[model samples]
Target: MTVALMWEARAVTGRGEELLAWARAQELTPGPMRRETFRAPQDRVLVITWWDADYDAVLPELPDPGGELVSRAAHRWRFEPVPDPT
Candidate 1:
């Protein structure tokens, strides 16, 4: 099975670029199959990482960027692809 982990954060005012750079600089040990980063209004940053593992498997994830860089703690979620109904 494949699992996708979502990590989202909102940077402090006027520090969106810094937060993006920080998030991009983080390296995951043994890296995920695929990783993507994005930004949105309100200085929100979102990162999604795909891994080939069970839904409950332990996988590497990005750590907190500290309180100074963000408005609040990051938000994370996990998802799996829907199976074909055939």
Candidate 2:
């Protein structure tokens, strides 16, 4: 099933530019569905939404990019699929 993964994580100060540069490099590949940045009150955070052909396809590497931030971060929320209301 085609699954969409939405992710948000705290970003390292002064490293935002570096991070974007890295992300640009990865754009050459065909994966990331969408990326967005926002301000968390005073902290700058990045949020991303990606869809995969299979749920498991994107599950494996999530920890490497997400759980391994410079300091530590938390996943605020997650959603899968919900049946439409008739």
Candidate 1: give the clashing pairs.
Answer: none
Model 2, range 33-56, lDDT digits (tens) per residue? 554544453233444555555655
Predictions in order: lDDT: 0.96, 0.45
TM-score of 2: 0.45
Per-candidate TM-score against the hidden true structure = 0.95, 0.45
36, model 2: CA deviation in Å?
3.5
RMSD of each: 1.1, 4.6
- The lowest-lDDT stretch of 10 consecutive residues in candidate 2 is 60-69
Report how far residue 1 has shifted in candidate 1, in Å.
Answer: 0.8
Q: Pick the candidate with the highest lDDT.
A: 1
Q: Which residue pairs in candidate 2 have backbone atoms (N, alpha carbon, C) closer than 3 angstroms, thus clashing?
A: none
Task: Give one digit per residue, the lDDT tens place, for model 1 in 8-83.
Answer: 9999998999999999999998899999999998999999999999999999899999899999999999999998
